[model samples]
Target: MALFFANGATFATWGIHIPTIRERFGLSDAALSLAMFAVAGGAILVMGRLGRQVARLGSARVSMLSGVLFALATGIILLMPSFAALLGLLVLFGIANAGFDVAMNAQAATVEAAHAHPIMSMLHGMFSLGGMAGAALGGWVLSLGVPPEMHVTAVALLTAATALLTRPLLLPDAIPIDNASTTDGQHRRMLLVLGTLAFLGLLGEGAMYDWSTIYMRDIAGAAAASASAGYAVFSGGMALARFGGDAMRKRLGAPRLLTWSAWLAFVGMLLAVALPRPWSALLGFGLMGVGAANMVPVFLVTAARLPGVAPAEAIANVARFAYVGMLLGPVIIGAVSHASNLRAGLGVIAISMGVIALCGARSIRPAPAEY
Candidate 1:
């Protein structure tokens, strides 16, 4: 979870500095977006293979190495002298992020089994909390006229220290699935359903993270500092709700919790799109965080517990879908934004979440009693 926190902090810090980098490089908006896509493209190419690599290297080693590499790659971007160097650093950052993502999720699944409880949501919650801190701190520091390089350096040091501190908690053991744990054809169908739902959930999340602030500032008439607050509030609400989601899941069950979460997120998106006020938009973002808090974690836990697939295989499959969503979500939103208004683009996200709420329950049935 601390690793998740550090990863979020690093990503958010970089995101806060994107405009600065673009201005420094004299990049057109299209060029900057393409550079972002280059990063995602790198992750898409490597995430699956990296998951298998984690199985061989063990989670602890992969997590530590990826964390260190991520920090180093992000720090290198601070010194980029041209657009080409920045793009290269972004690609490297993507590789580090994809590797770390697989390693950490694999580790979290193992930890959840050991604890015999719902913990993944809380772990991811810490990531959201860290993102909130990073964005807020980055904005605050930038407002004070600090150089982007200094900000990136401070975040890098913090990431390295945190990664070292948490290295011991990630164990080296793999999931020991019994050979008898085979499933019928139904399990394959279920896996497909769950993967699709995960894709949609991640799509909504990625869209919000990548575009919400821009929508607020450019369309909703928010100041730069106030625009950033949308992301901070969204992340903060997500973190807080995820910390408590285990109890909620126990009380509500996965099916109902997911249904309600999707509905809430749908409404939140609608609120943000419909309300023109900046504060209203921030409130909508908060609702979005609360509603999305546990959806992905629940999907992860559910996928791992499917009848036939080993925990590792299930995680890898679902993770592949997640990576696709993370890669495609922003691009799709950007395309829509270019063709129409940003609000119309975000409306598609709202509609997608609504579809997930309506259809996702059928994709993940409860496991049989004897499994």
Candidate 2:
């Protein structure tokens, strides 16, 4: 949980510094989208191989090393001398962060398997809480005239220190699963479904991460001082919801829980598109945070439990597909906004959420044994 929290904080701190970087580089929306693509690309390229390594190397060691590397990469991003240098650093950041993501989740899955109840959601909740803290604190420091490099450096140090301190607590290397009969046609189909669902869930999440602040500032006419309010609201709602997600899942089950969540995000995005004011935008994003907070965790948990494939590989495949959404989300929104308007672009997101709700209902159906 501490590892997940530290990783989330590291990423969130970088997120809060984006506007400053954008201003420094004088980047257009398209240019920024391209850079975001580079980040996603790097992650996608490395994740499959990373999964195999986690299995061999033990998730704890890999997670710790990757977490430290992730922080270092994030800190260096602020010091990049040119757009190209920034892009390169972002790619490096993506690779290292992806390593941390897979390793941490692998660790969580191992812990979950050993226990009788759910814990992934709670661990993920810690991630959301870390995001909220990082964003709030980063914004506060920026307001106090701290440079982005200095702020990121502080976050990096904290992340590295926390991971190092917590290193001994993570799961140890385990024997490989012996259930060779687990993989079958049904399992393959489920893998495809889960991967698709992961894509949809993460698409919305990445969009919110990359675009919510910009939307508040540019579309909702928020003042410079208040632009980050939307992001804070979104992250806060997500944190609150994730803290409750495990209990909710135990009560409602995965299919129904995810179904409602997708609709919630849909409604939230609709509200934002319709109102387009500062407070309304914040409210809408908060609703979105609630809706999106647990979708990825649920998807990941499902992948971990799937029969046939190794847990790490299953997760990697799902992550590969899912992260495509994150990779393309910014570029798609940017292209749409460039041709039309952000409002229209976000309307597409609203509609996408509806599709996700329907698909989640079908894809997350109970296993045959449960039925």
Backbone clash count for every predicted candidate, in the order shown: 0, 2
Worst 10 residues of 2 by lDDT: 173-182
Full-model lDDT, candidate 2:
0.81
Task: Output the lDDT of residue 279, model 1.
Answer: 79
Look at candidate 1 and give me any clashing residue pairs: none
* Per-residue lDDT of candidate 2, residues 1-371 (tens digit): 78888887888887777787789999998897677778788999897687677766777888889888988897688788899989988889999989889888878887877777778889998887787788788889989998778888888988888877878888763336444235688887887888887777777777787788899999999998999888779878888899888888878888888889999999999999999999899999999989988888888878777755566666777888888987777667778888999998877778778988988878867432221
Error of 1 at 293 (Å): 1.6
What is each predicted model's overall lDDT from 0 to 1? 0.80, 0.81
Can you write out model 1's per-residue Cα lDDT over 1-371, one digit (the tens) per residue?
Answer: 78999998998888888888888888898898888887787777786567557766677778888888888887778688778878887888888887887778878877876774678888888887787789889999999999888889889988877777888867654454342136467776776777788888888888888898898899889998778888778877788889988777777777778889899889999999998679778888888989988888888878777754555556666777887887788878889889998998888889888988998766655742221
Q: How many clashes in candidate 2?
A: 2
Distance from true location, Cα of 125 in model 2, Å:
1.9
Q: List ranges where model 1 is wrong by over 4 Å.
A: 141-147, 177-189, 214-229, 274-282, 307-312, 334-343, 367-371
